[model samples]
Target: MSMWIRIDDGVATLALTPPADRAVFRTALIEARGAMLSWDVASGQRFPDAEIHSPLEASAWLAEIYGEEIAAAVRAAAATSLPVPGSAELVDAAHRLAWLMWASDWWPAGVYTPALNGPILAAETAVAAHAVEHLLDDEDAVERTLHQAVDAPSALAAVPLRLRADAAALLDVLTGLADDHGIALSAATVSTSSADWALAAGARGQIREGIEIGHGLAPVRWADVPAQTVAADSDARWSLRHIDGVPHLHVSVAAVPVAAVPSTEAPGTEAPGAEAELWARFGPESLDIDIPLQGDSVGFTGNMQVAASIALLPLEERTLWIRDPLLAAVPGPAESEDDRDAVRAQASIRLDDPDASLAERAAAE
Candidate 1:
């Protein structure tokens, strides 16, 4: 059979000699958006395989063909619900996506954020309501339905996801830009290969807040529940969550230069449950260093898209330490859960003794 793998860029390049198994490559590029996979046709596998991941690393659907069927399968898998507001927009966007499948020569892969260049547009947001109602799984069938049914699809398959003329407000407070509109904040479903991995890399989700972004120092108050005491370190910074599940506040404090971090937690078998999970007093301490995202860090504080670029993803891919050496290496390539454990260990050490040198803690580990 012919081989294929899509680069981050949308072009579907083919390969003759294939070494990377669909599962491994699928796992590696788990979060790639605009991914759909067709096996020249879909055949029955003994057990159903499902891999969930972020838009960036989501698995490419295995399809019989790459066009609308792949798209349809995705819509089927999406099965739950799109983070849309009105019914009309949902219909429109669905159809829009369906047509994209046919025109793209059936990429068989699914539609990713980048492939969905623009936001779901207004006119088409409601396009999918009825037609997709019955055809449920054939992306191509669905697209043909849309084209045969609605407005003419632009010739280019790469148009951004049509932005709903009605831009939903991610938050009520996000009214400064555009008109007086604020769509309800919807959580983007963040997926990971490992459920445990997700919980561990959760800080990443805290960054996405489940939606597109708004701007400026969005005030994030991290007060421990029941206790009702917010962490005292409050300043303009890039925060990545809202009032949700387990509350966590990630703050980038200035890096403090120090030597010899005092050994606070003696590495010994502690009586299980004897030790408290948290020593709030040892939250974290470091010299103030403005955490930079994008570029300007000073006046930047406000709502941001949950998937807003980490700016560190590329580097993190190589080594988790590059972004925050204190951080355990991220779990992508050339790393393991051990990396995360290592980070936790280093952080624990650092937090125990705030005055310790970052260098010392890193080396000691």
Candidate 2:
């Protein structure tokens, strides 16, 4: 397998693989970039460089994984023709391919050395990228990782990829903050999960820590962004950041909860019943939650202030109830009901500390 990596020991020199061989991945990036430059000029809307590169970079790595023929259209774009598909379609297909490599065991996590503490999460992402890249030469693994990336929380094993131990520790700090603010979340049993978001040089890009985070896990684009707190374990000091308001929490290098499945009577929902621990982020520091009980009333805690007069969701309607409030917060620039609805489709209702604006801390407190 063609290997790609960078080693830096905080020195002037950095070790690395031969630059992309000026090969299929690079070729694809060039094509995607050229096409996008023209597309942007024609439209008079300046698409960011990162956006263009995000999908393209992923495609090149994918071509390395699956087969050149798999990326033929994308590669063709460089010298002669751009991929026949649209940019969005191209991005989706590439990630599907890269991840499929891992699903097939072509890129098992074992081959890479494990990190005990420093940058464990970054190492994991790097390992995943390496494994998938190594598998590109093989056809079978490419197909599998693509399928798994598309499926999610499906019959597919969750992979425990959420890094629950680490996220749990972050959550403890968050919940404590929530308690201090009296911010309460609706009582809905929510669980968290994650997917590796990667993009290659495409028509767009995003610079994370100076390196592109790729389009795969770009913050604005992730759908079904399920996030939740870590389950309690006596030995673990970690707490889960169940609130979805923190912008960067679940983006790159972070695990997210996707859907809140109700644990109580009414199944297939995100409502607070007898076991609701609704953790939500109002602003960066504020968290809102709704705890459930048999009676109509709900409870609140943390560094938040919930109006006692606030209404709690009925056990059955809790998930949808949280959904509505969040939907209302979508900004005024929404182009259509569909665009607005799309936002709601991805989020649910969790109580806010009423002080949940982005700058609630600097402004009021």
Q: Tens digits of per-residue lDDT for model 1 on 1-365?
A: 22223222333322223323442111111111333322211121111122222222232322322233333334444332112112222223333333333212211111110011111221122233232333233334323333331211211111112211112221111222112222222222221121111100011213444322222232111121111011112222333343353322333211111111112311111111122121111111221222322211111111222222333234222111113122222212332334323323433443244342221111122
> After best superposition, candidate 2 residue 103: deviation in angstroms?
13
TM-score attained by model 2? 0.21
By TM-score, the best candidate is: 2
Q: lDDT of each prediction vs. the true structure?
A: 0.23, 0.23
Please state every model's RMSD to the true fold in angstroms: 23.7, 22.7
Q: lDDT tens digits, residues 1-365, model 2?
A: 22122222311110112322221111111122112211111111111111123334445543432235434433333212222222332333334322222112111111011101111122222223333333233334323322222212121121234334433443343334334445442232334243221111111111222212111211111111111111100011111132332212111111111122223321221211223333323221223433221111111122222332222223332121111122234312212334323322211110122421111111111
Q: What is the alpha-carbon lDDT for the whole of candidate 2?
A: 0.23
Q: Ten residues in a row with the worst lDDT in model 2?
A: 229-238
TM, every model: 0.18, 0.21
